[model samples]
Target: MFFILLSLFIARVTAEAAAGGEESALLRLSDVPAAQAFIDSSEVTVIGFFETDESRGYKEFLAAVKQIESLSVAVCSEEEVWTKYNITSDTISIFRKADVHQKHLQLSETKKVDSDGLVRFFTINDIHYITEYNQASAVGLFQSEVKTHLLLMSNRDMSDFNQLKERLRALAPKYTGKMLFVLVNGNARVLEYFKLRSRDLPRIAIYDADSDRKWLMPKGEISAERVQNFCDSYLSGDLQKQNEAETSEDKTEL
Candidate 1:
């Protein structure tokens, strides 16, 4: 028992050291009074809880977070915070943005997550991650407690995709926490696996995870009004329900 305690203590010390508790980029529970005070005072602040397993992903995570929000990383060593947040894993990341409740980016502490993965994790506002790593993210969407999954599938062009993103951002506030929105690539393997397609540049699709049903937007039309109507119809059960094992082809409207 003494040896076990010693090992734990050593691990904790090592984790803290590796996380650079001294660096201003990372904060500690000991810094909570100040951190919380800052969060309370500031209009926007994002704090990241990083597992202290000498995980090399912190550097990449921190860099990516810097692009959108200034995030301060901390070792997941705070027993009080961990228990309160129900964070039982060593690799989970939590973010509290702009006075809202906390949000989580669940990833593997054991595996290294790339910058693109980190980007996707952060892009998902209050929804599931839209990732292409073996369709795991799509599978995660299917398993999510939320019944709605709004996925944006687009080709290589950024113009149409950007427009759709803007529309999604506008709709996010209206939906609040009722639905999940994710932006996916045009050539995502998950789409192929599900036989979903986007032939005419960009498209929007909805998945009612509860019923295991889906709805695809007709190609070539992506206006805010149309997207809004689609969402409204789904909520009102007015959208066409696609088969569980259906595959649609890419037909050009020439």
Candidate 2:
């Protein structure tokens, strides 16, 4: 059932791509099932629910989607699909699986709709399973419902930088929707904030944004097993218990 609906969307996109002479063609979904399939097909999917292809924000959405090639983009004029998703009026929405979030921008409520504004909306919500930390991406990362982040801190110039990144990427799917995997590469300010130096180059840490607390892994080989254990310990409350125990010992000495 799912594949049939998904193929309809793919077939439509393929036809449009051939006609438009561009691979970045926008998908046109005709039914609720097709819309759902498109949303579920990618980590991030943008759907513009409009009355018609000529709807107010439709053109802007089409232009903006061409610039952002990282995810899927579709247009749905089906009233049934809009009702299913609770989309009222002309709206541009993003469905992301990383945190199971839906972000909406209602064109009627906004002063203006342009390609640039639409592009910014997509960029600010472009959260993925494993996202690279940066100024533009930090907004999405910090605002994610999953507040805990597994950070792979390293200098990009290091020999094993890409190796560690791929290792972390391979492990990111395990914690998807529960925690966000972030790669902090060669950022001096971030290193200083974590009290780590370039010599400390490659390290793993679990940072909880809600509590603004961080647990840095002990100095050793950055094996996936060790990193996974560290995350599990934090999730199991063992790390909190260990911190409290150390605090009690400090009080006794004082």
Candidate 3:
């Protein structure tokens, strides 16, 4: 089983790096106590085991992890780490948020794994894992000059938003550099300050830096078709948008 899992991970490593980067986010470790502390402090961890850094999975998993936040990756090239973890061979182990619950994934030894799969694995139990935005970073997100954004405002459970991810991920590469898709928690002070209503539990909205306009997707619909069509319409200049008005009711239902 371990050998199969290792082989599967090695296969994923051979695939091309995704759009973002080749940088690795591995945190170097020297002791078991420190590793335990790291596990306790972090919500998730991905540790790659190898006798040396030369393993292909070591380089590949490290690079794949950089695209994700909150996931700590470390290369256990040292024999002490191997003995401590009881790993006799190469593998990528995913440690859940808790201190002890963890299991290695076979991750489809036959299928190719991409950045999407790695991110999905981090949030596998609930696929709608969205980034929470607060007052501090709100400006950078909503007003960035470099790219427009498709932002969803929601704090609902993963089940509510998970399905839309596939469509969003597909649209991402098609519109690369032009738009970034983000999810902001409903509890953000900035969102609360906007006086957004509870009826807006899950809202699809876009921020256009070019026109300084905010476009809201039609209400109560969050399907992939809605997302793709909305983006296509907006980018093609067919969708009408409005500014963030003073009144609670905006031009769009959302």
Model 2, span 1-254: residue lDDT tens: 85766667675865386444342466778777677777877888888888976688777777788888776877777788889999879998999887888988999999989999888888989988778899888998988889999998988889899999988888887887788998998688889889998888798988899999888889999999998999889889998789889889999999
lDDT: worst 10-residue window of model 1:
125-134
Pairs that clash in candidate 3: none
Which candidate, 1 or 2, would have the higher lDDT against the true structure?
2
**Cα misplacement distance, residue 138 of candidate 1 (Å):** 3.3
Error of 1 at 33 (Å): 8.4
Against the hidden reference, what TM-scores do the models get? 0.52, 0.89, 0.41
lDDT of 3: 0.56
Superposition error at 65 for model 3 (Å): 11
Please provide, for model 1 over 17-52, each residue's C-alpha lDDT reduced to its tens digit, 9 standing for 90 to 100.
Answer: 653433343434433343344344332334455555
Runs of candidate 2 exceeding 4 Å displacement: 1-6, 9-24
| Clashes per candidate (backbone, < 3 Å) | 0, 0, 0
By lDDT, the best candidate is 2
Model 2 scores a TM of 0.89
Which is superior by TM-score, 1 or 3? Answer: 1
Candidates ranked by TM-score, best first? 2, 1, 3
